[model samples]
Target chain A: MLVNQFLILGAVLFCIGVYGVLARKNAVMVLMSIELILNSVNINLLAFDLMNGGLEGSVFALYIIGIAAAEVGVGLAMVLLIYRNKKSIALDELSEMKG
Target chain B: MLASDIVVAQNVAFGIIAAVMVLFALRVVSSSNVVHAALSLVMVMAGAAALYILLAAEFVAVTQVLVYIGAVMVLFLFGVMLTRAKLGRDADLNNKNWAAGIPVALLLLGVMVYVLIDGLGDDKLDVTSGTAASTAAISDLIFSPYILPFWALSFVLLAAVIGAIVLARKD
Candidate 1:
């Protein structure tokens, strides 16, 4: 019933996810953290939407879902390409962006 | 506490899910293997979806499960497998990461809390009314005012699929 509780939870999740993104070196792990952050946003959207009695928030969250899917699509492709060329997926290794 | 039962329940639920999310995130950072990290992230996302359901956004909750847990987690799993990456490359969860990472995240948390508490300090955000009409109103807005964006989002999904396939396709 309290929107702030949900929002705070979302903020905590997003922060944790951010830490994962910044601290972890594996590109794959970074992608997973990115998923966490996005889901955190979705939680906020849905909570706010519920309080407002509107579909717009859930609807926006739906768009976010689409965006997340698309992100993974391209992200996984990039990871695969990087893996094929570099034989690795560690973030430390791919500074030059070639192969 | 007695006066705020719903709020208390919501807080407890949020606490549990937040802990789970953070724990899985820790697992993600600490695990060396890409596959393990991917699996751990599934728990994080699923916990987030559960939070959505707690908020009574039933549609969003289902979408979270279907879109994220069902589809996206698998994408991560397969991506890790396809890359043929080694496991356990980053098993260290020491204070160095905490020293650099925790402060920044904590700072962000502080900022968000201040903004939320300050923004809604005195105003009451009623959650009791509009229980029954929520679904109907949401459907109406989706079909009418927000239709274009709704369809555009689908296109976004399609484009991402094509782009990913193109990127990963073997020569």
Candidate 2:
């Protein structure tokens, strides 16, 4: 398998994720998009690990997974708090910090 | 089996998995219902795990399934339910200027694909060259050179758990 195939797959997924982040008004959807982005990065890392023959890339991928879990936990908590305050999770309505 | 046959088989598997992943990823972004989108994300995660196995990272593949599909997706579903999002379709799930995101995403994709193909043209992966990294080898590396980062990650997890509890708790 040519490495380009995997790399291009990563790029495609990453761009889709970016679009989701930009276009989704719902906070949870945005968080899901971020997961797509992270997973794409993980794919790229493991692909390179295969090409170069080392465990380093997999190590980083594992670290990324761990951090992503923590991130999602905190992110969902924030979303819950926002929903509690505003009764909505729309991203565009979040203008409290606007100055 | 011949080495060339193995490569051919790998390519075929990669093609099928990549196609399915891309489709599920598109659904993840475009699905109207929050729960449907989350379920689509689960498919994408499973597809990624399969691809990880194809790349000979069995450990990461298992971790992907266990952490992403097993734990993270469940959390996402809980977030969906707790946020009181409509279980069915929601019309306002997307931004009003969602069209603008398309061009931006396309531009980024173009640049990335061009760079990847240009920089690493047809570089074949030696899939048949090496054995899969043993779980023990991965653990050794993690405990040896990567021990510091591992410790830091633990702290991050600890902080996240406490912070989440604090943030989500009722007064």
Candidate 3:
């Protein structure tokens, strides 16, 4: 398989994720978009790892997965708190800090 | 031509999986229902694990399945339920400026695709080059030269746990 295939796929996913982050209103949707971006980065890393014949990219990918897990935990917790306080998860209503 | 045949097969598999993943990713961003979008994200994650396997990163692929699909997705669903989001389609799930995101995403895609294709050309992945890293090798690297990052990651995980509890508690 050509490396371009994987790289292009990653680029496409990353672009979709960027759109998600910018356009989505719900906090959970934004978090899911971030996952898309992270997965795209992981794909790029593993593709380069395969090309270079090294395990570094794999290790980094693992760390990324770990960090993503932690991020999801804290992100969901924050979203839960926001929902609890405001009775909604819409990002537009989160203007308490928009002074 | 046996080697070429193998490459051809791999290419086909990659194409199919990529297509499915892209479709699910689109749904993840475009779906109006919160639960539907989260479920689509799960599909995308599973597809990503398939791609990782194709790249010969079996350990990472399994970890992706276990962590992202298994744990993170559950957390997302829990958040959705706990938030009491609408179970049906939501008409205003997007912001008023949502139309602006299209051009931005398109421009970024154009730049990234141009750079990748221009720089990499037709570089093929040498799958049969015996460069696949075994699980033991990955662990070895993690515990040896990459030990610092491993420790840091553990600390980060711990902090996240405590922080989550503190933030979500009903104090």
Candidate 4:
């Protein structure tokens, strides 16, 4: 069991998530990127837990999944509200807060 | 198969799944259609769950499947459909300065790999592992020492539900 392999895999996923967050203009896509980032962190936690021979990491990962669900719920609701108001979900066009 | 063969097979499985995961993750970000992106995200989530199983965290993997792929993806599709996203490609799906992010993303990846490798090089898991804490032990931990945070998480979920309803409801 090569632990470094798993770590590198998680790192790659995290970087891709970061790229998605930065590059995507769709609010939903940004939320998706956040999920990817969260999943990568879960992977890291599980890997470390396996290395340390304990269940602490798995428990933490479970909580993270719960929080992610709540977060996406709220996030999607906000996106819906934005769409209702502005008729678009594009982040670039949501710059009304720009000064 | 022999025990050694099982390890080799696990490595191969990990390699294939990781490759597929990276590909779908890229598609999730770069795909022209929002629906396609959401579906691709499902694939990524499933792959993540598979990786968790590989890590010997079967219960976590099952929760991931149920919560992420089953529920979260459905919620995303609902949001996408309700938002009336254009079916075909959307021209404004990326920012004008998206190109600049490529370098930043690469830099972040490089830095992460460097630090992670230096910090935890070749650390092998203890093969003489004791019996993994069963679901019962995990539940006890969650209920005993971690109960406060657990309750707090429930409150957060409730708050999110109410907030979603409030925000999404028509006036």
Best DockQ goes to which candidate?
2
For DockQ, candidate 1 versus 2, the one ahead is 2
Evaluated on the second chain alone, the candidates' TM-scores are: 0.77, 0.96, 0.95, 0.91
The residue-by-residue lDDT of candidate 2 on A21-67, one tens digit each, is 99999999999999999999999999999899999999999999999
Better model by TM-score: candidate 2 vs candidate 4: 2
Colliding pairs, model 1: B32-B88, B32-B89, B32-B90, B33-B88
| lDDT tens digits by residue: candidate 4, A1-99 | 667888899999999999999998889889999999999999999988888887888888989999999999999999999999998888878767893
> Candidate 1, residue B17: CA error in Å?
3.0
Model 2 clash tally? 0
Candidate 4, superposed: residue stretches over 4 Å from native: B1-6, B126-133
lDDT of 1 by residue, A2-73 (tens): 568778777877887888787776677778878878888887887777676666787788788888888888
How many clashing pairs per prediction, in order? 4, 0, 0, 0
Task: Give the per-residue lDDT of model 1 (tens digit) for B47-86.
Answer: 8777666666766677778988898888888887787665
TM-score of 3: 0.97
Residue A54 of model 3 has an lDDT of: 92
Off by over 4 Å in 2: B1-6
Task: For candidate 4, give the lDDT.
Answer: 0.88
Ranking by TM-score: 2, 3, 4, 1
State which candidate, 2 or 4, has the greater lDDT: 2
Ranking of predictions according to lDDT: 2, 3, 4, 1
Show the colliding residue pairs in model 3: none
Best candidate, lDDT: 2
